[model samples]
Target: MENAEPFHDTRGFFDKIGSRIGSQAPAVAHHINPTDALLLLQNYEESEQGWFWSTDAAGNLTYITEAIASVLGGGSRALLGKSMVSLFHKTAEGDAGSRTLPFILTKKMKFNSLEVKAAASQDECWLSISGRPHHDRSGNFLGFRGSGIDVTAQRRLSLDTARLAMFDSLTGLANRASMAKKLETTLTAYRQQKRTCAVMLVDLDRFKQINDTLGHPAGDALLKQVAERLLKVVGQGGEVCRLGGDEFQIMLPDCDDRGILGDLASKIIGSLSQPYSVEGNRCIIGASVGMAISPFDGLTSEDLVKSADLALYEAKGNGRGRFRFYSKDMQQSAEDRRLLEEDLRDAIAQGALELAYQPIVNAKSNIVEGFEALVRWNHPERGHISPGLFIPIAEDANLIWELGEWAIRQACADAAKWPGKARVAVNVSPIQFANDLFPGVIDAALGASGLASERLELEITEGVFMAETNETNAMFQALKGRNVRLALDDFGTGYSSLSYLQTAPFDKIKIDQSFVRGATEPGSRNGAIITAIVALAEALGMDTTAEGIETLDEFELIRNLQVSHVQGFVYSKAVSQQVLLENLEDGQWKIEPSGPAHHRNDRLSMYRKVRMIHENHVYSIVIRNLSVTGALIDGLYDVPVGTKFVIDFGEGQLALATVTRSNGSLQGIQFETRLVSDGNGGLCTSRRVSPYLIAEAGLDVPNLPAGYVPTTKIERDSLSLPAFSTVADWTPTKARPK
Candidate 1:
């Protein structure tokens, strides 16, 4: 470009190039005129739609058409000898891919429609280049001659398409495809390296309620907020992705320690479940996480994902806002779940479900101030099923509304039969609170039962206050207008525990049971928490109830905190309707504080029926309380101190024991072996008669048979039974009449 004369037109450029070439190769191209060929080639190079370029064997530009030079925005001489690779550099590779334009060119491969960017240009310009290797007649490589077109607009479009394929449109998180590919790659590599990876599948609880109430646009905003929080939590070590709707998947590589994984899951749940402010409206939701680890829970992507999903279902099934791990035994059969659902539906419809009232007593006078109505289901065949197991089922099957309506009607009717001063409290689920017909349901129940609204208290968790929408506000106002009291239940378990106190209309705050159980242990913060809760309640002019008060120390600490009411075994367990009414009629509803002065390890206040065996005689007894080390028993009259016996905690949990203290009908026995978790929130002995052993003994069923005979010889003959002093009777001082 520097040495050649400028071409006035295509004809001049052709004649100049033709005359020079003809001088060097007059015999080579005698068949055609070089001047005519140069004219046609120059004409082709001058088109605006395309540009022509050529580089020597070293890949530096030897020539570029004048039109491309103008597009590059410089004189033709400046770009003629620059490196072609330096001018239009290839960009970073696409996601998870290895092929790049630079690499392709280095291989000397012919390529078409390859995209490159103008690295030296000031403007962001993309180009599509097509090139092929050139060779002289001697077959020695000369350089590359290529044609390129400006693909700036087309490049943007292609990039946008790639982004959409990899990212969620709503939250801008990695889409399912991206997550799947990453998980597969991670698992495959980690398996060979023996490194661990954890997968957590998070499903938002009560998300549908928000979606239906606030509409989809608000839901989208809420999701974006959730995504932002997750990104903050996950940070650098892992990836967070949206798996459509309100479900999310998190991939953590090189992490399999369940403690750390559990902590992360808990943090995610807490963060995501916090109240969301979307479009100026407050929305609340919760998350349940299920986690699985590679090389243990599963080995492949599909298996691991399925395991995590199952764990998530269990977490939600156990209770919302919880996390569960994948265990081998968690493979629940579909038929069993179906049968359970059908039975639950039948139980609700046929009045097999009943409510038990646990008294909330005034701390000073121990008078029955209120009763928390807890639902129970007697499966008739499976015996008494726990509310923990059934409540979640009712929620999942959309049977909560029906069960809730029944609870209200039944509670009101039962409350009518109680003393006029006694009040009844019932729990309200998020669905029940959000339903438009809930107010009418309450009104009808109150009217039909002739129960005063003042005697009915509705207990709600902080989660119900998540939505500050107009409709949600109206519902609250409507309930308050009925003159019924509102109690904030499980107060300190949620995020923003203090925020709800400012706006939520609550007459009472129930300190969550989790905080009450360990208030006495060394360095336990729960005692201080109780004190703070009581002080806050006083400031807000609201009463506070300390729940799960099982020991004398807990009660004293709670009373010191100035908690107004106490609801737990230290007062009274939920009793039958007949028991409640009889006590009310007899004027014996007042309970006196009675339990161990100091909390012991692994104590549980379980009132259940068990068997006491002494000297080969089996006697039925009532276990008033139990612990890992011992139990307080009744129904055995005048049992002597140090009497050797076997305490038969049901399900073949036989504990070898010696009575340490005997007082009237009650005796304290210490177990020789500690109990272990039954995997269902209860405890059992370390060993049990296996079902196979039961059948081998010719039992009628695979259970401890009545009038049983032990095949193993008794060892009590050689053991020493300690003779200890009789301890003083420890019933409630008031009930004992001094």
Candidate 2:
């Protein structure tokens, strides 16, 4: 009995351990004594699968398994008196269960399967620890008794799986699903704070061609490069994510200004569109961006995403290298575009499409040398549809081949009847040029029309260079073998490569209209660019044509630049075949150049209804023409010069203007603040009325228009009489003048 004191003194510790597993140990103790149970506990501690731990009333460790102490390189006595919480801390990798270990011990509560890692280990080692409060028979508080198993391998597996789920494996950017969840959560929090957020959807143009040509590994490498470039441009301003393949998404918090968004979008487009060298192969691609802002565009992630997608579709439809912000009117335009595509499919069959030829005259003599055949679609309902609108649609709908073949045949046939040896140039889409059957189509057209091969010119663009050099050269040889003239069109618009000029057998280089439009302006580098282009053409034994010379200044600049040919409205609009023949009835077809005497800012003529406000009165007016600096409007009678008015261009755009000139039912007003580009070849105000203000004004935030009346109380006695009278019976002209 005296020697039994050793067994009796440790009886409580053994009992607590026994109760944790079940009553099995106590039942075995009824048959044997405490000595045998202690022996069994010692054997269990020697096995290192799991280690047992007990803390004193103050959370200091009283006992630790011998195996762990030795493995830790500090024997049992060195670690014995340390705090249990200090020995293993919560894992910094955000293990959820381990986060509560300290609090659980402070409150003296039971906890199970908590995760932690050793604080002093050289290599990371994680543990899954379970503990409960140990108490006396009267239920007074004692300390914690716990057991832990090494969970380092399992933790590594879990973290790896989580990373794969949340990030793109190839680009290492956030994946689509992770972005969606983040957007939703962000929107939810921002709604409570009444803050703004923006989203941009970017779709890469011509990525498929590169993918198909260069192989999948190259494509993957290109995507990684794109991601890196995006991060550099966006920096910490936004979260950039790859939404699989060629699509990416950027989320910017606390931003609502379209000007800033547009600039960022343009930078992204310009950066991504630059040539990329992947695996030593040069590749070019473009990007289109669609943007949406929260609380104005949508209140939820799904709705905002849809708006951005629609804007992206519009940007791609108009032109690939551009960006568009979400607008209320885009919903209708999208539907109309779909219907237009269907109508375009039937246009060739129904004979609704025709070619109109604009003269390409010699710059020195103003003598017509040839005509560039532009395809025109006269929709029965929509009147004349611009090629700028329909050409890309045809390309997307796969109708370009059929339409292109028809155009080549029609253009040759029309030129066969000309009185002189004037040539006809037909545009060649890259898609058509890539086809093996294109040469035969041209041969058939020339044969059927009896037009000379020397008089038929095919105008190709730099986009054709996307193909292999061997294939492109082969196509050029086949066309040249037929004595067909090759003109490289839109030479400086995109991906301009000297390599293309050196390889392709081009007889002419046409300066893009964009260069010519601004070449005469002061501080413009476009003139230098054109001079270089003209010099390059001359050095290569090729001719140059300047396109879209709409002013006398531009005409003179082209002549001074020694560009060989000029084509634009400065001479005349595109004429019908009948008109062309009538003009050709007289010999040589020499025409005098005439247009506006001086260069002016580009003005877009259209009929758009808008609200004009003077003092407290509002009147409806029609804008006949619009420009960045001013507009000519109708439906206001005899407005005096210097009279100020507020013009409302709907969807929250407002501008202050003063009348500079007036006539019966018409006035030309200059804007106090110049309008900025809307990025769709249009002008818009740089700022808009805030949706928050609209809500505060007691108006429906979503449906509010521009130029709302002030909510602040106004003294009626201080109001002035209206400056101008509305023209109630005023009728617009039947149509826009050509």
Candidate 3:
């Protein structure tokens, strides 16, 4: 190596340092020279702290100081002739610019202070490698010489810092910022390809209960299990991230099919809702999923995520443990929720809450054995309010206890007014049941009403026993001690634990309606569940009530299974206190049951209009009936059966259907995935056309119920155009064999 004009004054610097050292010590055997100084510097490079290394023209290590080779667990020649890049690499695999020793060597420029991962020692090693290019006098390329220092501890600290910034500390999943960046990247890339992606925003239901009941540590553990289950369900095709607290986001790439998305969402909900075993205690919870798709629901990440959030709000509000897709007309505004909450507080305070009674009929006698009291709210000015709407808010706002107390008292009082020896049943929330004062509240309600405890029933769900199992059992025993019948409501619907049934003081088991709804259908597994539950109830010496029996088929099935009681629309719609009183005054509790002889296979009568697209042509039709699997429609001109048509139910809702049966203008068409509950006594397709797309299509913002309407005018496609090649002078009877 040469310097410009003159070489560095190495000899003078050595001589000055040597004389100063000699004058101080005066006992040196020999004077130190530049040669000795160079030797000492070389020796220092061979120590454990630092090392010198060189690479050949081909980027293979020619020589590495003995210290580095020893640190790498070998003699001096072990790593010799190995690719220099093999010794160290970039901390992150995809990081660019000098990712490894070879990559930097390719630049062939003097470089310094490049950090690379080197796992040469027992602990992790990061090498700060510096290098200068060397060549012969003829300018022929030779190689590179560099020095490396151990920076293991510092590098690990930097990595830990980066991890804290990107990963959730509690759950070890991607944090909010990391999730946002990943979503942004995926959306941007997918948008370019015109491919679709789906994002599901999940909020764990009743997560706060864990924090309140157990502790934050247990909650943290539950969160970890939740992450693991999500990872198991999502697999490698999607990314699951914890966006803080109980909210998690799962991103599915290249997926836009709503049927698949809905199934996946349902799976996630089911998986997450299973009872969590935390520190030997069972904790039951649920999740609500809100899904939105890209380039359809949104073109940007923010818009898509916001759409998902809105859908999630609807899911939670409608009732937790369900999934909802983004829709333009969904009204889950915070102001509306808050306003309802405020009104709910006032309504309960004002005694505006009322109870509606639905009789629980004995399967054998078809007589009213007990009446289940359902709470209803009439907002004075707002008319009748649905419990589905207000009950969740009450739970969220901590007003459920007040509502529960009123319902209990009102139920008991109404039962006291009845002439017959009928019992009254009231549903209890887990929150209310968890309180130590629940037994006192029940006694007070019964006392205030002057009703016999034997004539009243307290219904509790399975969740009541999941946490504080022993305490819940104590509560159960105390309630039963009051001579009030304790019925387990919605049994086998959620996280059902047989242990609870074996131990808790339950007088009866109310089979959840989900199993009863389709039990009579051919080959339905619900029948098996119903029968099993009935057998279990009988074995445990508890009565069984099948709820939600809307048809005679369900009633007969319950009778065949020897279920004790039936409560559903088939018996009676919940009636006000006065209506119930008038019925009771007739002196008999017997009411004949009548409904459809058999299950409808989920088909329902409907009268609606929708557009049917056949071969790019739109036809207007009126749906005479609808079901999850298919629909019957009228209004089309001699359309052939077996023709595939896209059914447009407006607001971007589209379903592919085939005309399976056609007689005159009436036709039967089938859908893809069965329609799920829209949470409002309605059914809707999972995916909808975005409002942005509608605007781009130059159409008005429309609601879901409205059938497809063209931007200009809603009309059928004209059929006057020549649909195929036509001869200029061809006749029907012309000779064609020429």
Candidate 4:
């Protein structure tokens, strides 16, 4: 080892040994002769791309070549034999004086490249360091040697990537992935220790609408503002992460008290409910929060997330701006609703639907003037389901048009079977009205049934006309030209009813059942309204119908108000066509009179009687019966068919009844009262007639006047005396005052 020509070409010895050991130990075998090793190491150390260094057994930096020192901003001579600890300024406690020393002692550690901040310039630097324990030929551990290469830019890029991976660019909070990872770890730990945790799913309501109406920049600003607000409100136990697009997920760990979850939820609601000023516009966005607690609402991450999501949907459904907790019943309800939706779609395709007719009767006459066709679903297993249950589902699924078409067709077909005078009222959903094909559907249904359009009445709520534009008006006008009667159903319920009634094209208005049900109560506002509506309809020349007339009182009240029609369970629940036909055939039809009837022993009596007097003699009498055909008195009134008679009573009691002798209106009149007062202190109501004979006599009044105007004294006196009177002197008849 004397300075013997410093064996520069020691590469041959390393090659020979490397050849014997194969390629694995080539680096170690290359440095064989101590002088040659020093020369080669010096050459490597002086190279710009490669730097060499050695660490002693005590983990001190014993040697540094000039090339390594230059890259680190110093000459090799200054760093040579200097302890590595002298280069590093320790900022954190417990950091080893030089991190490289641990690697040297733990020669089991290996590295292709590593990054470090250089102590010389205090600048971040990267190095490719590979080392093993230096040993003699006997394999005794001596020291460590490694090479270094600057990679400061690459190290900085790596740190940046790590930061970007965990943080959101806009809000600077943890992104979904990072938050999820943290949440999972926290949840797992909490579960292991039997502690509590909460997962909250927050959805900003109508945010899309806001984004659409405003601009995206405004939306972004609003989002940033929301993130800031959430950050401020999250408090100590929780962290908030934007899941994306108006949605955020919060994880509250170490929150042992479930009550605190509710409190936090309330705080969030209150905080978000406050108006936010964004881009010079005050934006108000409501938030719906659904929360799930660990080991209570759910145990696993998936379960918790799903439960919270379901609850969030529920909160949104309940008009938003609130929070809801996960519950078993809610889950079951959701499942059932899903099943119902599926079943409803299938039901429509299977044609398992039918229409039932509820008779709309004359409020005064109690005659079934028309029928309102109500849809019914006959599910194979579920029996009959009301429209209240499935109609909403159909509407939600956008299947209302198809279902509405079917209903219209069925209703029109049923109306075709009814008498020509009977009209069929079919409900039109708002969705159907919005559909462009609604008019075509109506025409097709009417054509398919061979029913006249006049016999079809389309009933819609006032809401249908809420957006009253030219298009809606045009559609309504077209329908009107087709002779389809447009009826305002459930009138007076909507806020725009008055405006709609005045503007929309409608032939009839049906007072809502709610009003009709309460019509008979004393001082009931509904009763007063019903009376006014009936009067208004009469004045406007439009028909009015009262719905939900289930009691006699309701019926009487409506009739007294002079409403044209009534429909409810009192007359009949919506029944099948066959039942209706059977009832019609059984001659069980009864038309209630317009006025209240006095009842004795459960039988209608004390009828309001109308009689005709001709030439100062009783010509005939027509009594308004309560439960039977209106009666007609025959004073040998063997009147021919279509004979119009002036029914006169001196005291404003006069009605005209055309005698249809063959069809026999007189036969239908049955007198239950024996002594009906003549209203002038005389009780003369004796009319004994054979039922068969009465049935044969046609007393039909073809031109029956609705009511008679008062007769002038001049007209009454103009009646001539009988032409066949004898020559005997006739005495003038005089009335005796009672």
On TM-score, the leading prediction is 2
Candidate 1, pairs of clashing residues: none
Put down candidate 1 lDDT per residue, 424-508, tens digits, no spaces: 9999998899889999999999999999998999998877767767776788889999999999898888865576677677899
Ranking of all predicted structures according to TM-score, beginning with the best and ending with the worst: 2, 3, 1, 4
TM-score of 4: 0.42
Which candidate should be chosen as best, given lDDT against the real structure? 2
TM-score of model 3 (CA atoms): 0.81
Q: TM-score of every model?
A: 0.75, 0.85, 0.81, 0.42
| Residue 670 Cα positional deviation in candidate 2, in Å, after optimal superposition | 1.9
For residues 34-127, could you state the per-residue lDDT of candidate 4 as single tens digits? 4564456456645665765666655555456555676566765555555654554443555443455444456534455544556667555555
**In model 3, what is the error at residue 393, expressed in angstroms?**
2.1
1 or 4, which is superior by TM-score? 1
What are the lDDT figures for the candidates, one per model?
0.78, 0.84, 0.78, 0.63
In candidate 4, how many Å is residue 391 off? 1.0
676-707 per-residue lDDT for model 3 (tens digits):
65533467776665554565455665321245
Q: lDDT of model 3 at residue 311?
A: 88
Q: Where is the poorest 10-residue window by lDDT in model 4?
A: 1-10
**Candidate 1 to truth, TM:** 0.75
What is the alpha-carbon lDDT for the whole of candidate 3?
0.78
